[model samples]
Target: MAKEVYQNRIELLQGTLDLLILETLRWGAQHGYGISHAIRARSGEVLQVETGSLYPALHRLERQKWIASQWRLTEQNQRAKFYELTTAGKEQLVRDRSKWEAMVQAIAGVLGPVPEPEA
Candidate 1:
């Protein structure tokens, strides 16, 4: 049962890593591992982003100029490529969040009759 829940969450997170990554960086710059760990932590361990997917997505986002990366030394004095959102990325994040929110609403509607929130 726990395995099933984890698997389902992984499936859901696959489609949202880009958005989640962007959102995580909104707090500040992070290296690849930090970013993935942050996502997992923020998602309450529901999302464990695999390196197989994460590195490619980071490269892709860097290519798109949605994010920029630079080498920096961590507190441990180890060099790492830290990624931070660009102005374009911030703009794109806003648009993407709106679209994501709309998608959630549409999916919820399809799922049917969620109880309305009290005002």
Candidate 2:
């Protein structure tokens, strides 16, 4: 028997990742690992945010002042930097959410409703 190899071809575009990161921060402050874990969990493991990709995104959002970071001790008593959304970030989230909803609705309209299955 041959084993099947799975691949993920979707690469999040330049700013999309920042948007997702910001949305995650909307819940509250979280460290790098916490953010990645929450996203994966919330996505039901369908989306995996790699550390290499996540760290850079966090730094970029921080640079843009969309998110703020501070050092804090984790439950394990280890020091780590946690991030939270700024007021500007909350506004951005509202805008992004609207944009995403519109895009999804547009795509759904193109696809049309699914046909009913036979009883």
Candidate 3:
């Protein structure tokens, strides 16, 4: 059952990770673990952002100057790097969201409505 549930998860595309990370940071500054938790919670467990993918995205976003990070102690008193969106990141979020919405609409159009089940 757990394996089936795990298998149902969706894998994120290359650009989508950056968008999700930026949107997650929009709420406020968060450590890497916190960021992943927030995304999983918000996605209702359907989207699991793996650490392998998450860290590289974090580093890339940092290099892009879309987010800034600082070392901070978590609630558990453990030290971690917290990241927050920069002004440019906020702008990028807006742009990415627009593109995402448009892509969703385009895909939906191509797929059309779902067929009804037979009685």
Candidate 4:
């Protein structure tokens, strides 16, 4: 059904919001809403990040010094906090990506051919 297909379109982000946010900021500084839109747009509208998750991750990244933020006015003149990746964030992103690739490979290995039962 169309509803089932729509449900399938959304997937659990599974602790990757940090990586996603970091990756998103790589392009340039953006406000919170802008970051969310960018991620959804990039993911073909499948990865819809909720505000409850997004803001906390942003703050956590800020505390960890992986990202930096500043209050800025949008084109519409609304005040919002814009986040950008730091030097440390860039390095961390590289590490995260390596880890992600390793995880995918490991899962793929587990999903590969099963051994035949001994007689």
Candidate 5:
């Protein structure tokens, strides 16, 4: 059987990833790869969370206090640092989610409904 190749072209805008990363932390503290997998799974494989992007975002969020990290052993027994959301992170998530929703709604209003083909 031929292996299926998945292409991920949806580029996440600057700072948008920070919001998603913070939200993912809300579930619980998770290591880098775990965070990537969680977002991909939650997004139903639509969003390809890349490690290159995710690591920097995680560090940025840590510096911003939206998340905090601590070194710990992974389920596989490897040492890794896990990140978790702080109180501020939760509050920020709510604000970000609202803003994103508004932006989406505004764009939808401008785009209008799709035209249906004649029967």
Candidate 6:
């Protein structure tokens, strides 16, 4: 029952995961687990990225040359692949951020501020 509820949970928009992953890497290189944790933490735990989406997105970004990955030892002395944003990724981040800002503004305009409670 619990698993079913989790499986039915809403996820990030179709392509927003790419932008979020790129944004997280802006800080520096991070392994897959670290990236997911960072996204959840930064979003105040509101967003939980499923591995099913994360690995594929990471691979897609790597193929697009937006991010590069290499194997390294973690603080735990374990081997892991760390991904870092490339120059192109940085540029894409700026573009994505601009689009996101515009999107938020448009949505806000539609929703409008809550009118003060009818006196």
Of 3 and 5, the candidate ahead on lDDT is 3
Q: Pairs clashing in candidate 6?
A: none
Model 2: per-residue Cα lDDT over 3-79, one tens digit each: 22222222335456777888899899999999999889998998889999999889988888889999999999999
Where model 2 places Cα greater than 4 Å from the true spot, the runs are 1-12, 113-119
lDDT of each: 0.90, 0.85, 0.92, 0.90, 0.84, 0.90
In the predicted model 4, the residue pairs found to clash are: none
Instruction: Provide the TM-score for each candidate, comma-separated.
Output: 0.82, 0.81, 0.84, 0.81, 0.81, 0.83
Of the candidates shown, which would achieve the greatest lDDT relative to the real structure?
Answer: 3
lDDT of 4 at 89: 98
What lDDT is reached at residue 119 by model 2?
A: 100
Off by over 4 Å in 5: 1-12, 114-119
| Residue range 5-77, candidate 5, lDDT tens digits | 2222233364578778888888899999998898899999988788888888888788889899999999999
Which one wins by TM-score: 1 or 2? 1
Per-residue CA lDDT of model 3 for 1-119, tens digit only, reads 88765554433366799999999999999999999999999999988999999999999999999999999999999999999999999999999999989989989988998878999
lDDT of 6 by residue, 3-119 (tens): 766654533364588889999999999999999999999999999999998999999899989999999999999999999999999998898888878988989988997777877
Task: Flag the better candidate by TM-score, 3 or 5.
Answer: 3
Error of 4 at 21 (Å): 0.4
- After superposition, which runs of candidate 6 have C-alpha atoms over 4 Å from their true positions? 1-12, 113-119
Kindly list the per-residue Cα lDDT of model 1 for residues 67-112, writing each as its tens digit: 9999999989999999999999898889889978998999988899
Worst 10 residues of 2 by lDDT: 1-10
Q: Residue 104 lDDT in model 5?
A: 90
* Residue range with the least summed lDDT across 10 consecutive positions in model 5: 1-10
